[model samples]
Target: MTAETNEVKQTTKGADAVDEAIAQGIDFDGSPIPPAKLELYHKVMALEANRQRSGVSNTMRSRIVRIGAKHIPQAELDKMLIDAGFAPLKDKEAAFFYGGK
Candidate 1:
């Protein structure tokens, strides 16, 4: 198979493994989703709901950006920034000083 195809297969396998583990009740080493996290999720959902009610676009990228701006995951934040026509930087130094790179 081509390299691209192999990479896709590997990613699919990894996702499947994760799904299977979850289905089998395998608990990965991490704290449970905290109340603050849930609150953030709710806040994001509420924002989306407001946008939808106001006939605005409810794009996932926009939602992610809004959430990320509130200090969500870096990778997710980077993706949101990219989707919003901003560059995704590798580190805080780049994001702060260079405005993403």
Candidate 2:
């Protein structure tokens, strides 16, 4: 919450009444994913679902790391992909974002 990067953030617990049911996580119908992971999930899903609509993957990961929450470790990105319904398409991707078991 710095002055420069000020943005409204929604918590999974205490959002507005409209978000009460969803709890502010990435809501895929009724499933609630954490905000950090869910943010990436939405973007990945969107890219896959409508590839022509978004030419963003080339720089998407770098941009996300720059703008996304500082607490979301880079390692979590791959799992976020999996949870969002896919796996990293390349070894470089896996090396960068793979979450250890």
Candidate 3:
């Protein structure tokens, strides 16, 4: 794999490694890192912080569904939602009106 992908995978898998890499001033690639990539990394770190703060288990799925019934004729999304502890949309209108709420 490329260094960028390796860096991203390592960052995701090991926080300590990411910190060590940062402390060592190791760049993901030979090029200078862009501000946008740093911003995205910070956002991911913030998300991790928020996840810890909320005491929300990462294994628990959110009780929000986005797929409308009409768009998904097989009802697979509904079944998945129900299995994930989310209420299925009863109708297309209701699904569209409150989808993701």
Candidate 4:
């Protein structure tokens, strides 16, 4: 391919990973992300950005628990939390997040 056909690509690392993915039109799995999906994502994120700020640490913890539970085992996640100087999961959180398993 010539220079005209070569598009500059962003490195999918660090804080700008999502932006890089959007610019490249590809997901981490190497599959092309649909433009419509990207559009909707941008729309929702724009709304989120404009939303009122609460506790930033609270938000981070909530997100970690919500997404982490999906990928990490209960014991492992508890260990990670404690290792990171955060409290381990509460009873209610354990029930809600790890209930099925």
Candidate 5:
């Protein structure tokens, strides 16, 4: 805390918001504002927060699963992909993901 930098904008008070978050075992990375303390918005924010914290890209397997679960027929799936700018795998099977993983 002794170390000082140009970037650290000092608050009016000696303490900062980070102090409170740390007290609550939270990590705050400024992003889209949380919707509200309301139950539904809180749930939405929790899901968003988890997704952001994971820092993982959606995988081809997951996408394929989602597509299959939708129960769209093959022809419709093909057209949807095309419309969404997805193309077939260049050298592999004809499945996986929205954008043709």
Candidate 6:
């Protein structure tokens, strides 16, 4: 198989493995998921899936801010947001996400 085909197969296999584990209520470490916790998670996710969205850009920005703060330096993340034409990090976000970093 071509490299791209091999990569796709590997990714499919990985996703299938994860889906199977989830369906079996098994965590990656092989522990059984708590039924209550899983039920709550499913309920919340169902609600979120049905919720109306403002726009794709708004969602993108929110995700970038939420996740990027955990991995990127504050200054870099702010620059990236601005460079991408999104709002720079707000004072609250800066304080909350990068406070002790």
lDDT values for all models: 0.53, 0.48, 0.55, 0.81, 0.46, 0.83
Q: Name the 10 consecutive residues with the lowest summed lDDT in model 2.
A: 4-13
Per-model TM-score on C-alpha atoms: 0.26, 0.23, 0.31, 0.57, 0.26, 0.75
- Note the residue pairs that clash in candidate 4: none
The C-alpha stretches of model 1 lying farther than 4 A from their native spots are 1-29, 53-99
Which of candidates 4 and 5 reaches a greater lDDT? Answer: 4
Off by over 4 Å in 6: 1-21
* Candidate 6 residue-wise lDDT, 1-101, digit = tens: 67744543454444277666567677655568899978997898899999999999999999999989988999999999999999999999999999977
Residue 9's lDDT within candidate 4 is 32
Poorly placed runs, candidate 3 (over 4 Å): 1-33, 51-59, 63-74, 89-101
> What CA RMSD would candidate 2 show?
14.0
How well is each residue in 1-101 modelled by candidate 3, as lDDT tens digits? 78776765566444376565554445544345566776788789889777634335322323233333434543676687677666554687455644555
Q: Lowest summed-lDDT stretch of 10 residues in model 4?
A: 1-10
C-alpha positional error of residue 28 in candidate 2 after TM-score superposition, expressed in Å: 37
Per-residue lDDT tens digits of candidate 1, residues 1-101?
67744543454444365454344333233224466655676678779667635323445444545445556656666776777776564565346533543
The C-alpha RMSD in Å for every predicted model, in order, reads 11.1, 14.0, 8.2, 4.7, 14.2, 6.3
lDDT string, candidate 4, 9-101, tens digits: 334556677787787788765678998998998899999999998787778778788889998999999999889877789999999999988
Best-matching candidate per TM-score? 6
lDDT of 5 at 68: 55
Best by lDDT: 6
Task: Please state the error at residue 12 of candidate 4 in Å.
Answer: 7.3
Sort order, TM-score high to low: 6, 4, 3, 1, 5, 2
What C-alpha lDDT, on a 0 to 100 scale, does residue 22 get in candidate 6?
Answer: 60
Which wins on lDDT, candidate 1 or candidate 3?
Answer: 3
